[model samples]
Target: MCNTVKVSPRKLDPETRAALVDIAAKLLAEHGAEALSTRKIAAEAGTSTMAVYTHFGSMSGLVREMVHEGFARLERQFAKVRRTDDPVADMAVLGYAYRQNAKANSHLYAVMFGGQSLAGFSLTEEDRQYGRYTLLTVIDCATRCIEAGRFRQGDPRPIAHEMWIATHGVVNLELGGYLIDPANADRCYDGMLSSLLVGAGDEQRAVTASMAASKRRRRREVEVDPEPAEAVATRR
Candidate 1:
């Protein structure tokens, strides 16, 4: 008779140092940072409480790392945004990416910014700059459109802030599951963007011109790379 071999629950590699860090993050994600404790994390990881202190120094140390990691992820995501010559389109893409990230990582967002501060946890200057970078991406695009005679000549800073608020509203609602009909999201966003840009005749003209320039640029790029001869002939 052949005997069946029983497989063991893959014992999480017993690297106590890294194990504590990961366990702490998992606890923070499930329960807010305030609920996180060195003892709980160590117990969850199947290690002793002293292991956490030895690895992270204290609960505050663990929280600091968690906060830092959250911002770092946001920074990395924004950094990967492929730069395009058309700043407006780039801004739209960045905004969309921001919402997607927030939706996917709601726990990270709550831990990082939800006003429930853990003792000894504070946003570092670099952490704050991660947020600034996101805002700057929007402002840069708005400025480019204005300078190229697309958008009206006005300070882009306030406009960028307005865009952030509009995007944030949709994200907050969607994350809370308050927005059930997905179709309504696109309509709301489009309307908000249009209302934000609407202005005097001259400003409207500038906006139209900028959009035209962006389209022309895209067309020229496409023209530079012609389709395969066989594909074109097949269409005929």
Candidate 2:
């Protein structure tokens, strides 16, 4: 799991390079992360297996790329939400977009933010920029809320961070199919957003709506997950 595998810098066109990674992501999404192999990815990308080595260094390098691209996808989605006079509404919409993107890209999301790195893959700081950028977008949205007098007057980073933490918990649980009712995604999701925004000065109405939905859900749930925290962390 290292990026130390070396080759000459690629001379392939950028499109071809992107194609390789794109094919790899699609394969991983469809077939699971363990399906990745230089030969298979190259075959799908219509390139020589050596291209993986030349362009990405190794399997681990490719995994790194997949992880980063997942966050890049998030950045692009959030970018599509236009700013508005109602920053609170804007933030709420962005939150919904975040969850939708997660649902749409579940497999990629699993690989990227999943609790563990792929075998033969290692993550470096550079691999984290896209994810970091997504966080920055959240902070930016929170900043807008504050400037619009929707949130408490203060640094938006912490506010953004709190929202992010809450968001991640729901996203992760949903990704694991731990939701009490899969069909109730919107309800739990809204609850989480409402819970986070309560601190931002939004009316508690969303909070009440979200909580009622949760209580209805918990009544039918059973405790089936027995995986230890460390195990979940290592292989999630």
Candidate 3:
């Protein structure tokens, strides 16, 4: 009888899995979703096509994990924004965190937000809801603002949604190359946040103070841990 041999698929470690997800994100960003191919991704990642299957089951599985990774990064950034006694200031910091996350992960941001669907993958409603969970931090901040009388009485969900809409608009535009000048983009974003807070029943002076506090906090973060060169270059 002929000897029989069995070969098991190679298992990917956590680091390799994360690297593959990032590689996929970069490819998706550079080539658009429809252009993504498992062979290309595997080649660039220095792995076999079977590695993708072994790790993620299929190309669609890898894309789904990309969406999860994007939101996971955003959640981590949001988690770093410590809450303060000033709810409005806290909310402002959250907004900044949202923008920072997008800038840091621009390649994944579009995929995370449904801007482009991968050729073989579509986000289910469940996946969309998972992304929305990242907004809970904002909702909590809005609730505090309402409780503090800084914002008009309303459901926190709508208030959070409004903030998300405003922030996302600016971020989307900046990513699309509409807001090219970094200085101009910063000014526009600050102005938009201030206006939105004012419209939400915050006093102009209070919004100004909150924004200043947010800036100070952000500056301290930079001083402690500066952005990577690539991120700075991307901004410029």
Worst 10 residues of 2 by lDDT: 221-230
What are the models' TM-scores?
0.64, 0.74, 0.87
Residue 5 in candidate 2, Cα distance off native in Å: 19
lDDT of 3: 0.80
Q: Candidate 1 — worst ten consecutive residues by lDDT sum?
A: 221-230
Clash pairs for candidate 3: none
Which candidate would rank higher by lDDT, 1 or 3? Answer: 3
User: For residues 1-236, what per-residue lDDT tens digits would candidate 2 score against the true structure?
Assistant: 66765434454545655666666766776787677788887766655788887767787787787787678778777776667565666676667667767777675677776455565676677776667778988898889877876677889999888888887788888878798898888777776677678867756874455345434433233112222222322231
Off by over 4 Å in 1: 1-26, 32-34, 45-51, 54-56, 120-127, 180-183, 197-236
Clashes found in each candidate (C-alpha, N, C closer than 3 A): 2, 1, 0
> CA shift at 90, candidate 3, in angstroms?
0.9
Tens digit of per-residue lDDT, candidate 1, span 1-236: 99975433243344554455545655666776655887677566665666666656777776666555555655555565556665665555555666656655565565555355675677678656656766787787678767765567789888788878888888888777788787687556555555565531125554444345544443333222212223332332
Per-residue error (Å), model 2, residue 158 = 1.4
| Candidate RMSDs in order | 12.8, 10.5, 4.9
Model 3 misplaced stretches (Cα beyond 4 Å): 1-11, 180-182, 221-236
